[model samples]
Target: MNHFKIFSTAAATTLLAPAAMAQGIDAKVNEAFATVTGPFVNFIFAPIPGTSFPWIVLWLVAAATIFSIYFGFVQFRFFGHAIRLVKGDYSDPNDAGEVSHFQALATALSGTVGLGNIAGVAVAVGIGGPGATFWMILAGLLGMASKFTECTLGVKFRNEYADGSVSGGPMYYISKGFTQLGLPGGKILAVLFAIFCILGSLGGGNMFQSNQAHAQIANIVGDYPGWITGIVFAAIVYAVIVGGIKSIANVTEKIVPFMGILYVGSALVILIVNYHLIGWAIGQVFAGAFTGLGVAGGMVGALIQGFRRAAFSNEAGVGSAAIAHSAVKTKEPITEGFVSLLEPLIDTVVICTMTALVIIISQQLIMEETSGHYLMNEAGTGIATVGGNTGVALTSAAFGSSISWFPYLLAVAVILFAFSTMISWSYYGLKAWTYLFGEGKTTELLFKIIFCVFVVIGAAASLGPVIDFSDAAIFAMAVVNIAALYPLMKLVKAELDSYSARLKSGEIRAFKH
Candidate 1:
């Protein structure tokens, strides 16, 4: 308690400083970070010459594409089964009180369905034009295959504790699956995966969530000192995360569906009101997707933004969801895998597309005359200033234009989404931390404390390089994870084949209505 007060005081002093002063401090931080991490980020996001499509995004897109083909589009074939799993239709009654596929799906969704759906779609449409939505939806569909494979392997190779706890993810799958395949160096690949997951959890999952949450609140409540928000958020999240608590994260899952319903409900209202423009908006999505709508990079730029943001939003190929899904207490490992497919669909296809439509339907694009950057549009009712900003501001403005009070509602929703995301990602990072640092009370506590501190830092600091580094770190996880996937994909295919045969043979028992 004493430590909490002291930490809160320090956060105010450092993070609540004037915006200009904060920018100065953040500038230095970004410079130092850029000098060290710039090359790696550059490599990860390096755009193709004569086009804006980056190599890392291409890597993810290719993987999703390959998996969809290899699985013969299992996401399509088993879509009904996936819904049933999430609905507990196939759940064994004897496993009562244990984690269900819905719980696992909600846990994973809490992480993937946060700011990316809100802010990321705004950025994609802002820069890539409305056509990016088309590609974003496409990527979400294809990425479902990646989700199915990684999650199935996660459960198949998980280490089930005697106490009903579970630990798995790319780290376990890579190490265990590789050895099972008579391949060497599975440990090395797993270690690399663990390293990236830890970094990614810190950057993309924790910092990005807090940073954007602060941004959204400040936009609505006035740009008061960031530390004020930072301190409050850091404390609340710390309590949930520091003790390896799981229920708060589960509680967060309850927030997701409400948030989604409200936001999407509001967007649908706007679409219906502007029914005549829906066709025009969708047309823009297709046109901009293929032609880039006279934008800079043409079709490639649209595809790059769409794919990158969708990957970030749903995290299909990154192998993070596998960690959360591994906890479901199910007789069939593949059942959890099927449930996992719903994440990208709800997150990207349904929610993100709605956000993009709101932005596009608003038809608010303000390109800077001097800097060549598109500023904010409040459905033409307001003007956005030119400066560094995330997509959250633009998203808020669009909804606020229609609903008037939506920004306030959005601010509340953002905080909940961000909090839920941090709690879930904390588990992902902790697993990676334990894989490297060993499991125990002290070790877990140490990592949690460090994670909470970053929450403060993320809320207070300038996020330019931080976001860049965070995005790079998230994509870096894909690099190591996909490496493991190639050698072990055949094994996953065999599992799918075997599971399908048994279900078809009526050898698998499911819950009766």
Candidate 2:
């Protein structure tokens, strides 16, 4: 243990050495990255003509809504069965796939259950008021159908190799499902999706995670260069992801549960401690949803902010989870679909809602008497911060108010959340890379190396334009993925029907029994 500690300390020192030398480099890098990515970010996030709504968010919301209606609200109907499947009640060990149902869920959950659930939810509630929570929950419920559709297709169309490895996700499903439907340009659509997935993996999944994790650490420990934190995180992430999906799944299965318990348990403690305010906080959420609590644009502002943040937070319609879910050990592709729907529930409904409740109950936000608008901060600037704190720091303040030592715990949770997200996204990005290039160890290793390098960049620099562009790239994936889903959703429905019938007839019996 002593030897291990010494080596670890030495490694950390080596990593920090560059931070001291690279004092002025962050500004230069951020400026250059912003200049290069500004146009693409603007184009991707551009509002619909004559409207403030970003077309990408509209695209995701529309897909989720349509899928919910078309699937007959399958997310709700099969919600119980999803839980059973996750528990391995219907799993067959003989199934041809890389990981178990639970591990697959954990992996996908790791990707979406990151800074977004913490900081993003806080941001939504801050600007949109507590009422945003209602719309966010509503959107998350709708998104369940989108996840159900895409993941079923992911499993159905995946390619199993001779070495027992698999390659799947939007790229496989789009190309194969479209061809089966006699559609042209299937490969083109698949290619575009792959490119976007890779970019999203780098920016939102990798950089944003590392950036926030470093910020949280800095909040607790005095200021230091972000590159040091980035390098250490990159090294740790590469160790897990280098082993491929099965390895990533193994680590995530353990980390995700512990991370969830720690964060949620803390939230639960705060909620329980402030039990008296629970009803009042909930009332605020409902009132804010419709009245907007005097926020700008009233209910419309709350609606937009809630929907926008929920779409970003749960990532159900984004189709990234489909990539992770595709690796599940289930012959019945629809079983994974059932399992996938729970992602939005766990991510948005449970976790994001918890954060929102804590903020509301903590009285981090206040209503102005005359204007009736929610005061963003103590100074009443409408900036949606507490004492000039924003994002995770704002959330820290909320939690710290309830539990004095919670900020330290939150920093640890942030690091774990960020690390899990990076490893999972590394897999997502790798699959996309291998899809575009051929599958080979050498090619895969190159992509992994590049991914690790970006972890450092993300931590070290504040590339707002680059991060924005990456976010656009992530949503752009939904554009191609959901478009593909629309044409091929009937196939998923057919699979679901068959699976449900087989289970009813005892053809798909519970192996555990």
Candidate 3:
């Protein structure tokens, strides 16, 4: 066993030597790319005056909110139905698809219920204050409408390849919707969305996940070196991802719920123990939301920040989750749409709220300020550096303050969340890659291999700016996706009407299979 471990390490090092060497070149290229593109992104995403929110987030939130109100807050009315769908009340395994409803939700949740829930929430609370959590949940509630719309289209426009494979997402919807509407540049826009989705899945979804997991493991389990973590993580990720959607589905279905419950349960325990401070924490959230310097920027800024974190976490308008939702074995697209509504609830409303509460309650205890509180640590290297740099650490600190071993548990949860996200995203990128570069077995294998390799690279390297660029790329895809969705609202409405009619007519009785 010792010899085998040594040999495995040696083999991994040899294989990764090229990646290490290539990192320097990749960095230089990335630096040059950033030099050209950085200003544009920053300008485009710049915060609105008098608020912490950015323009991009504001646009997304506005679009989503309009859709929600226009659609009659479908999320609120049909949430129970969505839960039934997720529980397999309407699942048909023999239907045309790669996975079951539960599996598909797990796969999609794997993508959304990830580091964003962990690190992203921390960043929001760190910068926007606990009050940001209130806005985040509000945005999440509206985001459910966006998720329903995009996912319904994802299923409605899905393509079943000759080999019985599935291909769907915003790319398909943009092109198909435009073609259906007889619009010019429909295919071109679809292709653009596909390209962006592919890039995002590669970077934010896969690489970022591996990188964060590597950091957490290294921090907890001695200096095992990032490459070590990367290799192991890559191996496991590749092993599951290479099996295609079924393997990804199987893993996520099991992991997503377990980790989610564990993390939430832990947070609840802490909240209960500090029951006396619940009111104070809630007060801080509201107080900060209305009167802090952060909110003084303007309602628009606050709206943007709240919307940005919500979109980032729930991914309602982003259209990435649509890829996963498309694979569900359902004849009724609206059923899946209803199921997709639960995503933002699980992600933003539930998980993210717990994280925000823990951080807010804990910060109140540690910090001296009662009004206009500010974290002194700007670097986020340790617990002391307060100026909002410590994303995951702040969450960990909050958990640790109550339960001594909670930090380690949270760390493990982060790894699982990140891992599940990477695998699911690998499939999303693969679909996009296959869409662009023919879906031959060889091409598919090539993409998977390259994806696995990047997992290691992301784990080993410092990609602070690269991750940001990738995140922007993901959000950019949403811009195109939501544009397509707005025009195709009738189609979703049609599907919803059809599903409701069927349900009313007893054509589709209580979901048995």
Q: What's the number of clashes in each of the models? A: 2, 1, 14
Rank the candidate models, highest TM-score first: 2, 3, 1
lDDT of 1: 0.75
RMSD of each: 6.2, 6.4, 6.9
Task: Tell me the whole-model lDDT of each prediction, alpha carbons only.
Answer: 0.75, 0.81, 0.74
lDDT of 2 by residue, 402-495 (tens): 7989889988998888888889889999999999999999999999999999999888776555566677788788888888898899998899
lDDT of 3 by residue, 1-513 (tens): 000000111222222223443367656855776677677456546667865556667777887799898788999989988888878887766678777778888888888886667666776666565567778889899988998999899989999866667888887888888899888888888888888878777777876677667666766775555777888989999899888988889888899889888989998998998899888777766765665434334333344455567777777888888999898887788888898888888888998888888877767666644344333234322112234436566677767777889878977887888788888889888988887888788999999999999888877765544555666677778778887888899889988888888888988866455
RMSD of 3: 6.9
lDDT of 1 at 10: 23
TM-score of every candidate: 0.88, 0.91, 0.88
For model 3, the superposed segments whose C-alpha errors exceed 4 Å read 1-30, 48-52, 293-302, 367-389
The digit string of per-residue lDDT tens for model 1 on 10-102 reads 222232223463467676876787778778877876777876676767777899899999989999999998887777777875551236777
**Candidate 1 regions off by >4 Å?**
1-25, 93-98, 242-245, 364-390
